[model samples]
Target: MHGSPTGGMPNQGAATHGLAALLLLADSRLPAGGHAHSGGAEEACRAGLITGADDLSRFLRGRLATAGRVAAALAWSACSASASWELLDAEADARIASPAQRQASRTQGRLLVRTARRIWPSATLNDLAKALPEGSHHPIALGVAAQAAGCTPDQAAMAAAYTSVTGAATAAVRLLGLDPVTVHRVLAELPYDSVIAEQHDWSALPAHAAPALDLLAEQHLRTEVRLFVS
Candidate 1:
């Protein structure tokens, strides 16, 4: 549903402009608690799996390949605006392995939903309120929020991909003590093509393949000196 970032064509309807949707997706104070979790990016940094400017591309590419599945699912679902939250939540929950990570997503998701309901009141957002549990997962909340904001699944997917990559890079710098410039450079190089998403379906994806991020995520959870939540 997202339109051109620079607004729509001359005399085109405002709905075609994606500036508002982009702001909503990019806003950091949306109460999603995204600032907390690193999506295992921190653990990778500590394990020496990621390093200076040379490693940025590979690191982000790997991360996107893994975590991008969840993002694709939620974003595609968002376009419908009438998706089943419970089903989608369960689908996303199945993707989650560690108990700590599952809880973290739920905590953030619920908080994000609450924030959305308050800041930008709407029927679709309220519908989500009545549909989901008190504590849904992050992707589930994001799906509903994206729908309410009039963003299509592809647009949602791009936002999700970018967000995951950014969250991990942020965590890497803090946890592994990596240089900020290097982190930003790698972040910038990460491929974020929305065109490759296709039809977004991971129902048959093997857990170990599309989501190897759990290895670092679980490891990070066991560490006593970690900075990020997960």
Candidate 2:
């Protein structure tokens, strides 16, 4: 029999391990309380901003370019940073203009942290929980979780970018009953590469504003009846 790279054992590359971690972190099935929030899709749907697949596509594209880019940069920064959780949380606060959006981010962050700590059990995640008793931003928690799972900064960024719009896309399917295949096609076309760029400076993370989304979030908070949390 032919011997493998490591003395007859199958070789497992770091990329393969990272890919698994990335998929788990990005999966909607994770008990991270992500199912409750729509990433502003509920509001957008009620506001008639996303009436169909084409409108949803445009909305998701815009979100991917703006909020998704910011989230990817923040997650990459957090994954790369060893002890800058507090600073990163503050930076997230500054970048999120809407109070409603900020609340949603922190809510998701706290839930993600709770789930990640139980699953990964890393000192980094512990420090993150300690640093922000209130809760770190969602992207920050995601980055730390990725690190604990043996994922690289790039994988963290990709996961962050992926989630930024996926929740909303799923929400749209529920809200408007749009074709799942068509919605997924839109998701497949997202320019993830453009959002998941390398960022060396944590302080200079992308702050692409989504005023419409922000307004939608604020409006959603005020609505008496809603299907999703945000």
lDDT of 2 by residue, 48-87 (tens): 8889999999999999999999999999988887796888
For 1-230, candidate 1 gives per-residue lDDT tens digits of: 33223344463444554446746775655556788877776777778777654665677777676666556555556545464667766777787777777877788778878886675556666766777757677766676666666566666667776776777777767765778887787777667783226444546432324445666767788898887788
Query: Scored by CA lDDT, what does every candidate get?
Result: 0.66, 0.89
User: Pairs clashing in candidate 2?
Assistant: none
Full-model lDDT, candidate 2: 0.89
Off by over 4 Å in 2: 1-13
Q: Number of the top candidate by lDDT?
A: 2
User: To one decimal, what is the Cα RMSD in angstroms of model 2 from the true structure?
Assistant: 4.7
TM-score of each: 0.80, 0.94
Candidate 1 residue spans exceeding 4 A from truth: 1-13, 176-179, 194-211
